[model samples]
Target chain A: MNQTTETSPRPLSARIGGGILLTAAIAIAVEASTFEVAFLTDPVGPKALPLLVAAILAAGGLAQLFRPDIDVAWPESAVLTRMAGAAGSFVGYAVVLPYVGFFLSTTAVVTALSLLYGGPPLKGTLAAAALSGALWLLFVSVLGLPLPIGDLWMR
Target chain B: MDALTHLISGFAIALQPLNLGLAFVGVFVGTFVGMLPGIGPINAIAILIPVTFAAGLPPESALILLTGIYYGSQYGNSISTILLNVPGTASAVVTAIDGHAMTKAGRGGPALAMSAIASFFGGTVSIFALVLFAPVLAGWAIRFGPAEYFALMVFAFSALSSFSGGSLMRGLAATAFGLFLATVGLDPNSAIPRFTFGSLQLLDGMDFVVVTIGLFAVSEVIQLLEDTEGGQAAAVGYGRVMISAKEFAETGWTMVRGSVIGFLVGVLPGAGGTIASFLAYSTEERINGANGTFGEGDIRGVAAPEAANNAAANGAMIPLLTLGVPGSGTTAVLLGAMLGLGVTPGPLLITEQPDLFWGLAASMYIGNIFLLMLNLPLVGFFVKALTLPRWFLIPGVAALAFVAVYAVNGSSFDLVMMTGFGVVGYLMRKFSFPLAPVILGLVLGPLMEKSLRRAMALSGGDWRILFDSPIAITLWVLALASLLAPALIARKGVPAE
Candidate 1:
């Protein structure tokens, strides 16, 4: 059923994404099949919907893997680097958030991003400080929502 | 008269200081995000959902804040469309045609004025229609049983999928992926874990807020980072921001007609603002195409589309409130928000939660008034926000998104999950898989499964029970019809009026 339709040189990227989806689908299906009960309670239990999802996903992934859209635009390395930096910083923020707390961590992340987005360091730093301070005050004091007070600050 | 009384009480709830302030903040932020090129209402609402929840506002107030963001963005979209020619979403693309042209002709101020005016006309008129139609639809929907509701959800999925843009297969794939995500937590009925993979956080399922933010907001940052060519800053109003009486006279009927058309179109499943504006523009062009300079800098062109798009935006809300089905991606997010707030929208929603239904309706009016107030006299202030370095604006929003995700579960793992979903989202955007259907599927999957099983259980596991009623049958036909609509309409060429 595979069609030789894909004309793009980097069609492997499409296949990779599709393969990931296919793998996820197969894994979900396999996991769902093991769900058991003392007796079948419903005509179609929870397994049915997921199995259907897996089937659809498998078909879709196969379709995509076999015949990828050709006009996929890949970003240049420079732009790709910036995107990676932004994503990496986000992950780093996630990693350090609990330890660094909402305030300092937020300031650090925002400042880094501002610089990445092309802000002067001084302006970025000030904006980050202001943003973090304002968010801390609004969420904590005004709204009375609890955000983590950094361990660093507490010590 | 009864509707009026209900609406008056809605106004009372809406008039409370906190609710009012939330509405103002919602619209203000909505307009700001809506005007920004890369960010749209979906991202804006996604970014705010966690914050609103953390604030511990009553569900109704949170709903009010979110719905404000919904239509508020409609008003805000015009600012960039007219000034910078970068319409935030496909809905505003038509507006940019005449809107940007008018700017070039030194009529940017009046163009902005007419857009706000037309949008206000659309917003208010559609809200009035919503008050009228929503109750009637809800009353009719109260008769719907599980089978009909199931069929209706199917119709929703199909309609959304067919209109999910580009490939039907890709949309289906995205939708299936969303359904798979929906199955991640423990199965509500069987009490069995489906795909948690032995993680504690997976027990409660993926939070829609985190998923939505990851899918829309976080991915957007990655996409923006990849874009080398940035938009030029929009010039503030050059001429009078207020349009002349002559200009109003010229476009008065166009605005009214566009509002009517937009509202009608918006009420249909998947026929959203993009179609509404396009329809309104074409209709107006047909009517006055003889003498009017239709394309290049015509104020009526701006009025027609802006009115239709805003009206359509409000019109789309009707189904979300009354039928528990959303007509567009934005409304899908709204539906998700409403569901998260513990409001299951359906026929009984009006009777069950009059405050939410009427309060939201009333607040739309209040929100439109605020949009008018903010956009007309204060257009200059909002425009200045555009001049702020993109570096600052994008990152700041990204930080807000991060904080919002962290606030959801107070876990770094969720942030990691958000990051992972961001990558998935970025890939989905690249592969042209429509993101909204994934959301619709994720939100509606449980309901779909529940209705399916309930229908079967009611009939002793007879699957044919799903088609027992005429309503169910009709809905099934409509579901199939929706998938066939684009093709049929394309072939028939939108038959003569």
Candidate 2:
């Protein structure tokens, strides 16, 4: 079995693409193993589809290993840092959502992302907050969709 | 007499003030969504599904709006392609060849006008074809059995994988990944949750809206963040939006033929607008080899693919509306919208819901007319949008995406889920693991599984029953060929244009 290439000397696009295929292959294997447990129930239950999917994924993974062509450029350090910051902002939004409400949390996250992407601080923050507030009103008030309105502040 | 009468009745429904208004909104939003780099038609359809649902529009009206956006975005995509050299969607990739070249040559005005004219030609022509062909396909499909449908779906999967470029194996894997994502929630036939890990949210399986938003829109935000030193597209001088009569006369037939071929190919599952444009452009290139300027700012080159892609966009609607089987990502979103609107669009739909079918068909004609009118006069206004700096546009789009995602579930948790999918989407893009299949799998997965189980039960567990009917056999063969043909052909051929 040709082991999936973890790192590539080629462009960043190829390396990233290869890495993803590897991750996908591994994820499928894990999902497939979980699916095997379903066989203990109904004889022809849900497991068969997962197993078939796993086999197809494996075949595709093997194909990539053999004849990879698309080149993936590895992201620069600053880009990686920005991506991490974006992720962090998302997590922060989730954590603060209930306490602060959708408006505050989303504004904070969007502003954080804009800053990470090199937007000027004051302008980005204002734009982010304004956008978040506009969406909250539009979805909640006009559309009648229920959104968390923060027990702490709204009450 | 027959066609005109039907078309007039269609206009009755389409020209209803409310329906006309909705169609306008759909195309207007579609153009904006398509102009943004990385957020394609799929994202627009998926994001808007819930909003339309919440608005409580009638099923036919809702469909009119959604379907309008579906094809309208195809026209919107070229704005960016010509101005920025960034093909926002796969179908527009061909447009960039001569489009950007024209811009660099300072003929941006002519290129922009030609794109609009070609698009208008493609749209009008295909809607006529749709008017002619839809009922015929529906009539034939009505005779098909569940077994035939199961096989047809397999063909759809195979064709998509084969045509997805790079390696067939990788495409199949991407398809499999999509199918796997589809299996995440609950089995439709059996109520047991398959991959949900006991979460109530998974009970609905994967929401196509959530997944699509995560995959396309959210991932785009991450990409924008990475390109810190992003390049802004120089806005071209707003010249004449009208194509000179001579120019239109030169490529008029090419546009007609391209539209015909593109519409037909687009009706099939797997090969969608992307293939249609590629096929049309290559065919035009071949036919006009010497006389044609070909790649070097050939007006025919622009006209053919632009017309074909637009026609193909309308063509893909046939399977989605008539058969309830979606062959592409955007159509998959449309199907989801249909289901959400409580309209089951299938073989029986034509006979059972003639008004819906005829009304949607009519609305499309009106939508195209509106698109032509909207695109030409307002081309300058939309082109001016390109002048906005990247730092502003990218972050602003991301903010809107975040709100759209948040709008769906009204929970920050969905935002988190969206972010996770964004990362996955970015990886999928980087790896060339065809994102469309994931969507195809997610949308078609339940249907495929239900068909499989039903076929098995009918035959008392005989697997061969799937291949029993001639139609089934043919589809299976096509599916197998779709899986193999790309590897054999693409392995040694020129890189995908």
Candidate 3:
């Protein structure tokens, strides 16, 4: 069902998203066409699926471009900052995990996320440390899945 | 007779101490995760996949645990819905209407009791139906050629995209995106790297666990952070969760109808517990007409949706186990887990690996019993768990997710990819794009492509071969019809959502 009563112009965000999707679809098609096969493979080669996917994406993009739904209400800047912080902490955790080890890096990222969710510093860090330790025990000591022990320490 | 014999031997395996213990843990953790806001069965199951893989359990045991979480969550979802007016999952959304109304009227105990009983009834009925129907469907599908399978997958995509409760275009776009993700890394037929972007790790293809955790769990953490208005803790004093004989008698028929509707709807690709519960609630509302207090604390209102959703949860397993096709996102995750366990489910699974099939079926019965016992008497303990501070809980979940993603390939690169998908997932949610179809597309994409290529190869590249067989033609028609069904339903003023 149409959410709005009157026909409103397509939202700028939807148009931009659609344009990106369309461009990606063309790019996929072009890339797929260049997939050269050395010998005679199956009747439908690897490119068939990608080309089909490109066509479907193009159709979706064209639909969005012509008739976009209502504009999404993006979160306020404060909330956005928190989300970005959380995402950044996750990326940072990945980057530092090998250097700082699982326990330290996991605790840091979890504490960072906790603070973003309004937890106090002292308690958040404690909880994060406890959680990270417990996970290490479970994954390493119990299940015996090998997690990184920090290249810094290993060296 | 053969099915009964298999089920008997299955019970022998299910009753083993190890399988039973895992079943208990599965339902217990399932209830806990399902009752919490923002953490659903999908996240719990996804996060546990790596652990299950590491544990090196038999395929049957793994399936038992994962499917326990699948159905057990249905029972747990109503706990928060009734007590806090917060639905634990989308399937529980309808339950909140009557369930919370009952709570407001000081009848929360009876409401919770009715929900448990209804869930138990619906679950048991659907499991029986699953036992009876799976074999018949598998036998029928045994004749299906690649063309038929290709068409069936198309039907699944169309049904999911149309029924995912959004504009069809966005759903299609999401599905395309998932399929595109599936096409990443090395192509299955050829060794060509299609979209690896010159990365070494990309050679293995995009792992479903990585994508699932990122899109569902990681995005969930981000979304929860955006909402500053934290939910207030629910009161635990709801008296004993027991219903009167009269109340049970009144809801007996309601539970039956809901179970039937839920099971039938769950068998179809795309529609799951959410739609099943809605249909059951509306049907009961219409049947009651003027005399019914459908929305305002009616006991039947509580019974109808709870039963339907639980039954629908169990009903979803039939396709997953028998057809190797998942009808909903949760089942899609289950299918992925099944694949990871080195068990391929299809028509032959019943005949070939009867132990796995029957063992799972038997464990479901045990799992449902565990759910009833846990929900009926020990629900207070669970309600107290709802008071777990969001700060501790959310980050804990995130850490678990982090471990699971890292465990996928033991590479930090996956972690980076996970964060990227998380942002994309958040943006998709903001724009009202459904995420389930994306998973469905990702899980089913490879199979669909293989089927298409096989079918085309058989016909020497003739496209019309796709429509050659009667079954293939029928599936094509069904796919086209499903795509148009939502539009027609909307035109008739039916609230499809």
Best by DockQ: 3
Residue pairs whose backbone atoms clash in candidate 2:
A12-A72, A12-A73, A12-A74, A13-A71, A13-A72, A13-A73, A14-A71, A14-A72, A17-B431, B185-B205
Candidate 3 at residue A90, lDDT?
93
- lDDT of candidate 3 at residue B109, scale 0 to 100: 89
lDDT of 2: 0.77
> Looking at candidate 1, what is the lDDT of residue B19?
91
Model 2, which residues run further than 4 Å from truth?
Answer: A1-44, A63-70, B1-6, B491-497
Task: Identify the candidate with maximal TM-score.
Answer: 3
Q: Give the TM-score of candidate 2.
A: 0.93
Candidate 1 lDDT score relative to the true structure: 0.83
**DockQ scores of the candidates:** 0.44, 0.37, 0.52
List, residue by residue over B9-110, the lDDT tens digit for candidate 2: 778888899999999999988887778776668877777777787777999999999977876677778888887787878788898898878777777778
Best by lDDT: 3
* Candidate that beats the other on TM-score, 1 or 2, i.e. the better one: 1
The iRMS of model 1 comes to 6.2
